[model samples]
Target: MNHSSDLISGAATAATGTQTTSPEPPPRRRLSRPERERSIVEGAVKFFAEVGFDGDTRELTRRLNVTQSLLFKYFPNKASLVERVYQEVYVGRWNSYWEEIVADRRTSLQERLVRLYTDYAKTALTWDWVRLFMFSGLRGEAINQRYLGFLRSRILEPVAIELRAELGLPGPDRVPLNIQEIELVWGINARIFYFGQRRWIFNVPLESSVEELVQLTIEHFIAGANVLVPRIVQAQIDAAPAHAD
Candidate 1:
């Protein structure tokens, strides 16, 4: 009856009757570029969800019913495809929201950052590909670099700049943001959002529906950040993400 329960019901329905991976390929045979990409990406998510970033490409392609060479032509090599998948497929449509928020100027900085993270949490629960993104973050450097790009550009820089102006942050907020702190906060909210998405089947408790959770989370951050004297009000910046604590 609650939002999480409703989301759980809807996701369960949407996940049914649809084959996640394409049919297997021919024995000892290669595949076309598009087919290889399709097979590898689709199968890769399964591997990512289970085995993570270092998941075997051989097994991945084979499951797609294609030869390794077929997969190679499309990806060139295994490591490279990991980068592509992280950026292109794993993040996918999520990046569009990224560009808009980072560039949009119609909302306050506080609104922008909260909107960004809340939207992120909501999408994580709903987007099937997010499983791959979440799992991949644990692998190592290749994934770490991808993570860094996201933090620096999408998360940190925007927050650093906007927080400075919005809160008139006078201390460390002006200097370069700390990576460790950024990663910590990023992980915390990500964990919460992910739990909300899975809705207890994964064994994590959900406190609210995805939509309500996002709204409450946004408000919490705004209230916490507004403690700075005379919260700077900018009505032109697009709503997105941030935090120091």
Candidate 2:
């Protein structure tokens, strides 16, 4: 992941009457403002992911082979450029229609969960996305939090509702999510996220293909949910303070 951006050539020194090291210059290219801005941001994503958020903008410009001033013209600063990278990578990649797909009652709950994850893993399980996500997490970046919020509101909540429905329990709109139910769904969701981390970040060998993994995970999840939800709902009911008749 390291790049030539941080390298300094130790060739010569004039004061010592000895050769001084000069880093090799980046290749020159005549790109328009929009084109060059795009290029800088693209390079910055890879550069930041490799060296991290603390990585120098000078190195980033070197990687882009552009003058620092030119990069500033578009981004003003590294933070601004990082914002665009977040927007491009995290926000832009979101499929708005995923909610609809997940909420489609025509599909069985098991089928919906599997399909939702299959679509998610296809796009979000890449090395760049996972690495950037981990990097942002370490930096306490809000973008990753926002993405998680999106997942809860769109993906996780819907699955919870569907899970309850599949077991003939009341929806969240009625009984709402009990602690046990929430934990149940979070456990399932966490396993799916870890699957991506294991595959991409850890480079673990997966015995199941993406499709097989999704199907297997959801099937097991649904099996557990069917048995757990009723017991959880009863526990919640018993825990409620009874009113005097």
Candidate 3:
């Protein structure tokens, strides 16, 4: 009978003599033009979200397991790739229905606002969305500027107009939104936005659920607006220079 030590020595000798090779990985499938571009865009969104606009293309290509030349074939440059990421992440997530929700006067202003913010949180409060936006702002990238302009024009301004209507104040066409009025609206938006910041950036755990907080925020805004907006409009009217009758 072979001893255990003798059997182990024989197995070791056999293993050393026979070189084992790993099985070859399956071949990568060639992507169609659209598929390839889409893959690059999707990968770039995650990459920039992780490392920001300062992240280099070489690293991005490495992360994507694609050649730099292939990346350029689709995007031509890093700026173009960043732009595509902005479009995909920022613009793509925007809902046209948000505009409708803000403009829907059939619903009470408080209800509409709560609904809109609740919907907005679904897209805007995520890790990718919040992180990418903060990174872009830190880098002083144009993404923040562009998106803010869009927000002011589309959402904030419209909400201000609706607030005016709710308070029986003249529409913006009659008396354009004063800076105070705009900033008041912005205050509410800022409060909601900070909830995301505390969550994603500062890594703070919020006790209240997003829905609960949003409803609370909207309620507070409506309560304040009901009191303050009239005074704001009245002050604007008072401050206006009297024209000769």
Q: Report the C-alpha lDDT of model 3 over 1-245, residue by residue, as the tens digit.
A: 85999999889979889656799999989999999999899888888877888999999999999999988999888888888889998899999999999999998989999999999999998888988999999999899999989988889889989999988899877776888778887887788889889988899988999999999999998898889888888888888899998
Model 2 TM: 0.81
Instruction: Report model 3's TM-score to 2 decimal places.
Output: 0.88
What are the candidates' C-alpha RMSDs? 16.4, 11.3, 3.6
Predicted candidate 2 versus true structure: per-residue lDDT over 103-122, tens digit per residue? 78897887777778889887
Badly placed stretches (over 4 Å) of model 3 are 1-26
lDDT agreement with native, every candidate:
0.59, 0.78, 0.89
Measured by C-alpha RMSD in angstroms, how accurate is candidate 1? 16.4
Of 2 and 3, which scores higher on lDDT? 3
lDDT of 1 by residue, 1-245 (tens): 46999997778878885546888876875656676576677676566656667678887876777788867877898777776766655456455665478456588865675667666665555444555555655554355456657656766555555555556654343344444434434543565556644752365656666656666665665565555222322311222245578
- In angstroms, the error of model 2 at 67 is 1.7
Model 1 compared with the native: what TM-score? 0.60
Report RMSD for candidate 2.
11.3
Best-first order by TM-score = 3, 2, 1
Which candidate model has the greater lDDT, 1 or 3?
3
| Candidate 1 error regions (>4 Å) | 1-32, 102-105, 126-130, 168-201, 228-245
Q: Which residue pairs collide, candidate 3?
A: none
